[model samples]
Target: MTELEYTTFGKTGLKVSKLGLGGAPLAGDFGITDEQEVQRMIHAAIDGGINFIDTAPLYGNGESERRIGQAIVDRRDRVVLATKAARSDMRYDYETTIRSVEMSLHRLQTDWIDILQIHDVESQPYELVVSETIPALEKLRQDGKIRFLGVTTRNLELLRKYMATEMFDSIQFYTRYMLLDHTAKDETIPLAKELNMGVINGSVLGMGILADAPAPFLREDIQADGLARMEQLAFLRKPGPKGLIEPAMRFSLGNPDVHVTLTGVSTLAALQTNMSYCDGNGLASEEVEKVYALFQEQPLFD
Candidate 1:
């Protein structure tokens, strides 16, 4: 077993594990999840030195937060709990924003969230996020409901737009920074580093594509592209228990620019496997250069 490494989260000065536990799988978004099993996995993750956990109301309609809250209520001090608002069952209005955070607090069983992010900001109107959504988060921060502000979006362009505002303490983007798509490293990641905002890289396994189980909701074109790319990178796969998963996990874990790489696992076994990759190992310098040369500026999704 390898010891987990910690990083200073951007300018926040919050010490976060290089690997964080993501909440979608626990919410049963990926498949059927057992409540007891999920709780146990949370405990194991914390015990294994994974301090940062990310979740959102969109994941199984708050089931993720509810379960996680119940699991960590007694050990909350050991984790940097993070959850999202505005993408739940309400509009992105001021009142709804406040209501959303309050609801998350209830589900999480915590008085205050370490990080409260504006979920999928690109899906909402920019003016709404700037005028109403942000103000609501600011109010929550002032009210001691959340300690820091962050934003999540798959749209790299929109992510940069929000990062430019300088209001957020962190930024999270998925899929774009994975093996099949290295587009984020081109600008989005550099911008976040330049602004000194914590960078959370989600979907490092390309939503299970790297694990040989692509998500059902992905487009046929994306699924095909990911599979093809996976085949091309077969040489990087070391003979091990996880095969491609090992390299996939290390790809993001090894990146100095990525502060936190989120691992979405439903079972204790999966959590343990991901935890094992946190041993300060990443792809070789030559392998990284080869991947960059292969993908270059080509993005997998439109």
Candidate 2:
């Protein structure tokens, strides 16, 4: 196998693998999971040079975090662990935020988190995030509970609010660099670059559409559109030295602003395939430009 690449997590001063393992699949979000198999996959990811793991309480109701904790108990220092705190109710107050962090810490079985992000900041009120949530996170940092603070959002306006506060060390957002959407590239990415914040690119596979998963397997809202887009992207998957996923992974990695690109896998084979793509050289600039040109005329989705 080729060597995996590593990069500095912007402003955090921690070196992270360019490809990080996402925790959703571990919780059986993709399908029914075998506990032992999940453990093996986590170990395989770490052994394969994945130094970062991201999870959240919303994923399978904390089962993901629990499995991760068990998988990395002895190897905690080897990976940078990150989890999110979801604002569960209308009461977006400091106590609620702190309680979420506390629960996350227990579930993760870690004394201190490498990164604790506010999950889906756009769902909560901006004033509450500014007045209560961020301050509570700051308090957690000061208390030696978390090393850094981050935020994840799909809302550009919410992202702007996060940037203005200058409290976030990183930002996680969905960017289908391989697909038609360029919202992240056109908006939040530049602002994050200016603030020197790390960028974690999620939904790199367009919720599995680029991977050619059947429409029945996709989310309800995107099934129709995703299937159509998959048809358009079928040419990239023709039997070749490099398949569609390779180019998709490479495209996201090619962006200088993207510090880490996340890929969620339910099986060992899927994990290995992603690792291979990370080890290989990214797509050539001209090839990337060609692909981009083909999708350039397509409508941008939210």
Candidate 3:
């Protein structure tokens, strides 16, 4: 196996693998997942030099964290584990925020989480998040339950709002930085760099659209627009199954502004394919310029 590259995780100072394992697929959300198989994949990820794992209680109602907890119990020290608060079932109040992390800790079977993020902030009122939710996370940090604070949202404007708060050490957004969009480069990513926050780029494959297995729930307009945009870049696809997969993964993995490019894979083969792009490779200069120019300041998903 090739050695994966590492980077300093923004202001947090922890070194993380450029390719982080995302826990959504392990929750069986994408398909039926075998617990033992999931454990093996997690171990494989650790063995392949992947030290960053991102999960959330919202992923299969805590199933992702539970499986990861079981897999990493003996090797917990080997990775930089991250999970989120604010499940879809609960309100994002201070009490709920505290309870969420507590439940996550129980499910993850860990005393401390490396990074605890406020999940999907775009769904709630910003004032509520500022006055109540963030304080709860702060309390968790002060109590030594979580090391750093972070936020995840697909809304660029809302993401910029959170970044301007300067309270978080990291920010995660998906789809915006992929081959189909690349809008994060317009502002959110640069702002994150200005804030010295770690940037975790998720859904580099556009929730499977780049791989020809587009998520069923994607808005018709997003799917249509993305597919249309993807069509113009037929030249970038490889010669294998869903040729866009490799380029999609490498597009983000090769980015200098992105600290961790998450590959949310359920199968070992998919993990290996994503890991293969960590060898310090990116698109050619001309190709990169073309992709960037294709959607300059154009938001794909509102």
Candidate 4:
């Protein structure tokens, strides 16, 4: 087991594990129907020394939180619980956000949430946050229901817009070590460090793009070309022995502002493999540089 190093979340200096287990896919992405197996994997992560575990209400519509609560029922104090609240149809106002957080606590079977994020609200109207959500989150903090408030969005613009407010302790977005892109390190990372907000990198494996090479998300009856890009990255990336995923995981963690990188991996073996990067034998500088160059060489054309 690796000795997980802790870092400051924002200026709080509240230590959190560098590698966090993303509790999204564990809900149903891998077709894990057995509760006992899911619980075992969650325990395996905890036993392996992961202090931070992140989940969301939208993940299987709250199934992820339920399973996580079950697994950590006995040792709730050991986990730094984080969850998000977001609804697409009508914007979730302050009261709804509060209700959602409380619901997540009930589902997670924990008294207090360590981190509560405004999930996916980066794309929504800004007034919704200032008018409704932030106030509610502040009230929750006052009431001792949550320890910290943050935002998770895939947009860099949204982060920039909210950065000036000092309303959030952390900002999350999709960042990875894959050859396909290094946008996080080049653009958003510097700003996050400048703002002193902990940058959490989700999709650290490009949503499992680099995790498996020979095998991929293939349908049973027919085929699709969704994997063409993945195969190209696997074939093109240089100076690394791992497939697109593992090397990328190491590369993302190499960033300084990145306090924790979320790997949405399921099962004990997969968790062990991801944690090996923090064991001090991760991707070499030369290897990461190669991937970075590839992204620089081929910026996505918008």
Candidate 5:
């Protein structure tokens, strides 16, 4: 058996590795994509002991879901497939959110979803979440369109506020070593556990930053927020250690209470490399020390 570890999704009986396959740029779903190459990577992750995969209808316009679905159709029963709806990137709310889930199921070719989330919940205000959003989420859950309903966002305050209502079964938040901003390393996670919510950590690599990436693919100078991360951050000034992608991934997988960490695998090599970290103790203390030193010397992304 592969060395990957498993945990239940929240209090549910759904068992998934601490590391789950994230389908994003790999699926090329947003526009033009390499379906064949992404498929190979998907299988590699499955074979490497990743039983959890997270995707969304908005990712590459449902491209990631379709590719992930096709890759694991035969093995669908073996995974906890999670996808999100209710994107704030558009004027979407309750009705459109339901439509998004339906479309995602059609694309994923699955009759039921293990986890269905409210995508980009923090991008909007709390009123939106309490109003058209939460009600619709409740509707979907009642309709049994999804086995569990959760919210995916980085807003700890908002998340805490929602959790106070005791409505969701799970949550998706961001947690990583390089996290300087929008990180829940403080108390959100502990509270989540106390509240009995499944916690899935997203952007585990900081969008390839921990991959010691040359800056998450540096597309263009769009929003001021992104422009700030353009290569000048102290944490990224010096390149990360020469280790493959495994060390960072393995570290995230070790966090207790983390049901899964979603990593976007771009290639077959990327998937294999990440699985290398699945062995639990992929690095010795000194090796981990070297990795930490590397982080200390660079600019941290918040």
Candidate 6:
């Protein structure tokens, strides 16, 4: 077993594992509901030297946080836990945001959250996040309820707007640094580095599309297109020393702008496979370029 690599989470100065455990799977989002299995996966991640765990209240309606609380009994201090707060209407309101954080705290069973993010900032008005939502989070930080504040979104325009404010300690977005897409490398990642905010890259595998697996979470039309694109990159699945996952995982981890790569795993096997690629070694530069050339002219979605 290779040792997992660790990095400083941007300006926060918190050392996080290069590969962090995404909490959606624990909520049984990926068709996993066995409590014992979820606990096993969480413990396995920690035992494997993965300390950064990111969860959100929207995942399975707080089931993810509840399971996380149960999993990290005496080991809470060893993990850097992160969770999100989102209004039921998917809008940003100060009162609802505050209440959401309180509920997250109770479910996580933690006095202070390591990182508290505003979920899906793109769905709400930017002024609301900047004027009301962020100020509310600042109060929580001052009250010592959350150590750091951040935001998660996949919308490029919204991300650019939030980065300009420089109010967040970290930012989570889809890097999509795979054979099919590499949009984050364009401007979002560059701006993140310039502002010195932690970059947590999600959807590194294109939400399972890069793995050539069917992702029922996606809409039918999007799923169909993803499967077609997967076929285009079928050469990567050929018998070799490395398969599609290695190159896909390494592509995101290889980027200097990415501090942590967030991957959601429902089973221990998937978690172990990902950990193997976080051993501080990524694909050679030329290999990465070759993979990118295959789909440089093609965009995964509209």
Number of backbone clashes in candidate 3: 0
Query: 109-207 in candidate 6: lDDT tens per residue?
Result: 889999998888867887888888998899999999999988888776688888888888999977355566776676878888889999898877777
TM-score of 4: 0.87
Arranged by lDDT, best first: 3, 1, 6, 2, 4, 5
Q: List the residue pairs that clash in candidate 6.
A: none
What digit string (tens of lDDT, one per residue) describes model 1 on residues 181-217? 8999989999988999999999988888888888899
Question: Could you tell me the TM-score of candidate 1?
Answer: 0.97
lDDT of 4 at 162: 80
C-alpha lDDT of all candidate models, in order: 0.90, 0.80, 0.90, 0.73, 0.69, 0.82
Residue pairs with backbone atoms closer than 3 Å in model 2 (clashes) = none
Give me the runs in candidate 2 sitting further than 4 Å from their true place. 87-91, 214-221, 231-235, 238-243, 294-301
**TM-score versus the correct structure, for each prediction:** 0.97, 0.91, 0.98, 0.87, 0.81, 0.93
Decoy 3 TM-score against native: 0.98
Error of 6 at 121 (Å): 0.8
lDDT: the better of candidates 2 and 5? 2
**Residues 62-143, candidate 4, lDDT per residue (tens digit)?**
8999999989999888888888875554477977888898899899998899888888875568898888889998998999
Instruction: Report the C-alpha lDDT of model 5 over 221-256, residue by residue, as the tens digit.
Output: 322333354333333233456343454565567666
lDDT of 4 at 262: 85
Stronger candidate by TM-score (2 vs 3): 3
lDDT of 5: 0.69
Residue 206, candidate 3: C-alpha displacement in angstroms: 0.5
Q: RMSD for each model, in Å, please?
A: 1.2, 2.4, 1.1, 3.8, 4.7, 2.1
> Candidate 2 versus the native: TM-score?
0.91
Give lDDT tens digits, candidate 2, residues 176-282: 45554555666678888889898898878776666766324555656666656656665556476335677688878777788889988868888898898776377
Worst lDDT 10-window in candidate 4: 218-227
Q: Per-residue lDDT of 15-83 in model 3, one digit per residue for the tens?
A: 999999999999889888888878889999998899999999989889999999998999999989999
Regions of model 1 farther than 4 Å from truth: 240-242
